[model samples]
Target: MAISSYDISSANTELARRAGYVDAQWALPAINAVELRRLQRRSNLHATLSTSLWLGLTVIAGFAVVATAWSWWSIPSVAVYAALYGGASDSRWHEMGHGTAFRSRRANDVIYYLACFMLLRGPTIWRWSHYRHHTDTIIKGHDAEIAFQRPPSVARTLWRFTHLQGGSELLLRLVRHAGGRLDDEAKELVPAHERRRVVLESRIMIGVLLIAVIATVVLRSAIPVVLIGGSTFLGGWLVVFFGITQHAGLQENVFDHRLNTRTVMMNPVFRFLYLNMNFHVEHHMFPSVPYYSLPSLHGEISSQLAPALPSTWAAYRQIIGAFRRQQVDPNYEIPLELPKIEGDARPVEIGAESWMRGPSGEVIVGLETSFGLGELRKVDIGRHSVVVGRTESGSLFACEGWCTHAKVHLGEGAVIGEEIECPKHNARFDCRTGEATRKPAKDGLTTYPVTVSKGRVSVHLVGIDSVGS
Candidate 1:
């Protein structure tokens, strides 16, 4: 019998790799660097206020559940509690994990760990898992986050509504990781050095759950467990309700999110609960864009992408039809009328036209008329790569193209307070001076002398020989 194609180690993995699906650069909508940078902005106040509201409501619901224990009212109270604790936590887990939720790295991590515990996910483990998901969305044998695998099982998909089966699987994985055993998929996704952190986090999570179990036993009531661990399953239905609409029955292993993802127009209430994830296609296409800015992003690129579904009801109807067909036809893919793509849509900007030689022997990077403030663009000169940016105050700066801590392209990161922040790890660097200003990035970047002159943004290689020597 052949191993499942969904397994990260299966032969299908190599086939996907050979077919150029694994970690392949996907097509992007025609949003320029300037507009994207504006959309990618993070707000600490937005994150804090939303988090406070969510947690505040959860606490109130929890109190209601406790006050009405074993009564008929407890039913509705518990449901509300679960939705707040488990359901809402899913979005928080995702956005925080993306590091686009909070301007402060610590703020993001604090909520990330809390949500991971609520969802029974390992912080370190799922962080890398989600990165892979973005790198290979819905690609068979590569994307670990593909919720609805092919030969779609209606039973499993419906079972997910209860959150029992899925939540239990996460719990089982938590236990296994606590025992210091890494699965094949985990091994494949997480770095070898980071595996130890997974074990440590798993053990910590299991210890907390064990305490909740012991408290339930000591109190001679299910209240303790119901309030703590049980909420994960109870509220999980909301997670499925919003999550299934994201990519279910859509085309997979494709470079275009418009083909593989769905965006739904939602009411203010649903948008609040799901954090604008209703713009699912937009989020997947531009992962760096914060959740709060997704709506604006959709508006910005709507003309270049697929139309958003009119409503969640409409999305479900379309998905159900696709699911029924897929049940019998494993190769079935929902037909999508993809927009015509003309130029390379990947974010990186390269080639001779992107730069020119200045009169004073400096290298012109981009035109001042086009390079808006906060815009980050990558320009390559032969083997050397440089990222050119115009700070918010209209100051021009240039530095080594990638993050010093990781190979992440600086052009993909956000500009905040004269600093460039890494999209992956939240590391910060002084954009003007190229100093490593934050953690996870100890080594500084090599800054180039940049000046805007005569409608041209140019960078003089001041240290071409002596700035460092």
Candidate 2:
């Protein structure tokens, strides 16, 4: 029998790459610059409050479990703690992992590691893995995060709810990666630069686990491990409960997120636990937008997306039906009657058509409105592919178009305060001076002088002799 297309090393992987599926540009609904920027703003205050609340609840629940120990009341108490620890941490880790939860890099990092450990996910390894998940989405053979593999297994899916098998696999992988061992698929998924960090982080997680195990042995009690490593298995059902609803039985290997993702209407509690991730389609489409602002973002581009499922209950029915049919046919897809998006447009300014010679030594980039606040344009001039952006504070700046760390277009990224964040890796660059403000972006960008006068925006060109694509 042929290898499954879902296998990373299968021939279908090469086929997808050759067919332009891997790292292919996904379609986005157009939204004006100003509104998008408002939605994209990250706030430390918001993230801090949410983090504090979740932590506070978890702490209270933990104490309750201790207070009621050896009594039947401890069961409910532990359940609450597990839901907060094992369940809610999944969403927390996801938002923090994207660096969208907080404006402070330190805060995001702190939460990301905490959430990852709670869920038994290796911090560094899963960070890179998520990058692939976003890059390829549900593209078989390339994307590592496909929740339900083709010819879906109902039993395995049901088993995930117990978290017994799922959590063990994660723990086992952490051990392997900590020992400096990576499978072929993991090696290919993770960049060489990130592998060492992966190993280091794995060791850290394993060390923590070892300490918990030793405590369990020394104390002659399961309490130590129960509070630590055991929390993952106990609380993982919540993770599976919320996670299974996203992208399950949806279309795969598609460039349009609207076609492959769902937006389900959930109650306030579910929204809180999932961190507003029920806007899965919007989250996937505009990843730079923070969790706090997802609701507004949905309002901005809701018309362009499929109607939100009436409820999570509705989505589950659809998913189950699709899964059942796919079990037999293996190639079935849930028919998503997507609204026709006229123009199928993206919010971008093409360089070739937008640039002209100004009266002075500068090139007329566009009007002030053309390069509005929080807008990045890829301007190709002579030998340069320049990224021109207006920061949220209404200041204009220009720099190299591609990320120095990775060859992704900076125009597709979001401008955060004074720094421009890479869409692919969340690497940050100083918009004013072109300095690499954050990693995965080590090399600074080459900046150019930008000027605005009488509502006209222009850029000073450097040694331009020819214009070619």
Off by over 4 Å in 2: 1-3, 10-12, 345-353, 366-385, 392-395, 404-408, 439-443, 451-457
The number of clashing residue pairs in model 1 is: 0
- Per-residue lDDT tens digits for candidate 2, residues 155-217, read 988888899999999999998988999867678767787788888888999999999999989
lDDT (C-alpha) at residue 132 in model 2: 80
- Identify the runs in model 1 with alpha carbons over 4 angstroms from their true place: 1-4, 10-12, 341-373, 390-396, 402-409, 422-469
How many pairs in model 2 have backbone atoms within 3 A of each other, for residues 3 or more apart or on separate chains, i.e. clashes?
0
User: Candidate 2: lDDT over CA atoms?
Assistant: 0.84
Structure candidate 2, residue pairs in collision: none
Candidate 1 Cα deviation (angstroms), residue 48? 1.5
For candidate 1, give the lDDT of residue 315. 96
Candidates' C-alpha lDDT: 0.83, 0.84
Name the best candidate (by TM-score).
2
Q: Can you give the TM-score per candidate against the true fold?
A: 0.88, 0.92
